[model samples]
Target: MENLLYLFILLALGKISRRLSAFPENTPQILNLFVIYFSFPATVLLKTKNLNLGTDLAVLALTPWALMLMTVLGIRLIAWYRRWDRKTEGTVMLCTGLGNTSFLGFPAVAAFFGEDALSYAVIYDQLGTFLGLAIFGTLVVSVYGTSTRPSIKQIILNIIGFPPFLALTASLCLMKVTFPLPVIKLLEGVSATMIPLVMFSIGAQLRLRQPFSNVKPISLILFLKMMVFPLMVFFCLTMMKVHGPVLHISVFESAMPSMVMSGVLAQSGRLNAEVANAAIGYGLVLSFITLPFFDLLLKMFP
Candidate 1:
């Protein structure tokens, strides 16, 4: 409960900063880069080291893959049926299909599930959602993007070049070898910035003006992201006989808002940036309601 409060407080602070013009507009971008390259990797390395790998963990890691598959198929069929343009289809696909697994995800999971279970959230973010963003995300952007279609080689290289992916590799290598206590402490201190910085960044970028104008698509996006997608994850994982923390954490992470980075991707890719940004803004606000509801629903599972 206190953890959730901390998130809201930090978010309010960021919103306040935005309203007061306390920082340069580009500040969030730099903060995002730091979280991606420095804070996020540090958290992953520290948490995942000395971690045990198992089949259930692998299933957790694969959750986003399943979600993305469903999203792509669903969006393509819907677009075909509705005769939506490529850009609109791609925008919705990116925003709704992916999630804010890292930023909002880390803190929310810690708040709801506690620190001990954070490693599961890490797996869901890095292995599941991050992987989707790097590979599959790029594919969606390219296919729908006005930019020249990138070669397959470029896609592989881009994934390899991502700092978090590199960190994942290094962390795997270091799993068997213990680090010095001082180094571990250093990593922990840096990684701790992830939650606050992420929430603040989200708040800073929020723009609520005319949010209701795009109500129809935003409503659909939220339904898929906040409710339908998470429920789908729960039923699928439950049928596999997976229960307890793994099932709970996976579903909770799925219920997060649209990825903030998805809006950036939409703009850069020449997709419908307006819809993407609207989906993100509204999704972030609505998630506070849906997340807790799903948390209670998952508790009823077993």
Candidate 2:
């Protein structure tokens, strides 16, 4: 209960910052850089280091990739049938395909499931969603993005150099070895900044109104992202007999709103910003309703 309030408060502050001259226009971007470079890696290390490497870890990690693949294929078919332009197709693909599995995910999961479950959330985010952002997210943006596209070589370099990816690598290497107490404490401090900063950054970027003309595409995108996709994942995993926190967290993370970074990418890539930003903004708001509904739904399988 308290955690959810924190989420809303931070988000409200970020949104309010948009109206204040004291908060610079680039505030969200600056905060994002800190999250990307420092807090994210630290959180990855701390959360994942002691992870049980338990049952269905593979399934948990693989889940987001599967979600992205399905999202791309599903949207492509819809886009083709609708004869949507390339930019609109790309915007929907980018926004709908990526889940806010990290930024909004960590705190929300903690609110619903307790902090212990966050390790699984970390696994889902870093190995699955975040990697998807770097590789799959970039690919969508490039191919469907602006005419100014990055080369294959440059893309590979980026995935290799991404900071959180490096942190995942380091954590994997150090998993078996115990860190010095001081080092763990240091990591914990830096990582603790993740939730507030992430929420603020997301709120700062939120835009409630796009043109009313945007209604249909935005509606379609939200349906897939927040509703259909997660339900699809839940049923499939249930059929495969996936249960426990693996079943719970995977479905929970999948149902998150559009990735905050996806909107940023849409704007940067010169896709349809109106659709992309609106989906992200509205999706976040709607998740307050959708997620609890999902939590109720998941209780049946668990």
Candidate 3:
């Protein structure tokens, strides 16, 4: 409960910052840059070290990608069918396709399932969603960032230069080398600041009074992200008889709101920032209702 309170309070404080004269207009953007460059990499590097690659671990990590694959395909098909503009398409692409498996997911899972569950959360996040951020997020932005498609070279270059991707690659290479205790503590300390900062940024940037124009796409995104896809994951996993924490956690993660960094990605890519912000802000509010509802349903099976 305290964990959840932190999220709501931080978000509310961020929203309140707008009314204060001290915060500049660009404060949220600056926070985004800091998150992308510093906080994100620190979290990745800290969590990924000493990862064990068992078959079960592989399944845990890959579940999010499966969700991402469905989301990407579904969004593209819908966008093509509706003839939505590229900006709207791009907004839906990044926002729907990734889950907030780190910031919000970490605390939410801990609150429901207890702290031990966070080990699985880390696997799903770092291996699955974090990579999605560095790979798919970057790819979508590059392709739909402007009217002209980027060259293959440019896309590759963007991925390669992406700071979080670089950190992920480096973490993979350093898996066996144990860093000194001081270094680990420093990384942990830095990574701890990520959620508060991100939530604040989301609160600051998100407009509560969303435009009606974004209603259709945002509604679709919420439906898929918060409801349909997670239900699909639940039933399918249950059919497979995949019970225990794996079943619980995977299903819960599938239902998380859109990745906050995705909003940052859309803004950075020059996509539809308004739609992105609206989707994220609304999704956060909706998750509070939907997550507990799903939790109750999961307990039925348990």
- Please name the candidate that would achieve the greatest TM-score relative to the true structure: 3
Residue-by-residue lDDT tens digits, candidate 3, 1-302: 56557777888899999999999999988888888888888887987776775687676788888888887788889999999998899889888889888878998999888899898888888778887888888888878888877899988887788787788889989988999999989889888777778878878877777778788888888888899988998998899889888888888988999987887788777898778877887888898899999899888877
lDDT of 2 by residue, 203-233 (tens): 7876676666678789999999899989899
Better of 1 and 2 by TM-score: 2
> How well does model 3 score by local distance difference test?
0.84
Residue-wise C-alpha lDDT for candidate 1, range 5-111, written one tens digit per residue: 67668767877887676698776667777777788678768755665557758977888898899899998998889777888888888988899887778888887
- Model with the higher TM-score, candidate 2 or 3: 3
lDDT of 1 at 298: 82
Q: Provide the overall lDDT of each model, using Cα atoms, as 2-decimal numbers.
A: 0.78, 0.81, 0.84
TM-score-based ranking:
3, 2, 1
Model 1 gets an lDDT of: 0.78
Positional deviation of residue 129's Cα in model 2 after best superposition, in angstroms:
3.6
Name the runs in model 3 displaced over 4 angstroms: none
Q: Which ten residues in a row have the lowest lDDT in candidate 3?
A: 50-59
Rank the models by lDDT, top first: 3, 2, 1
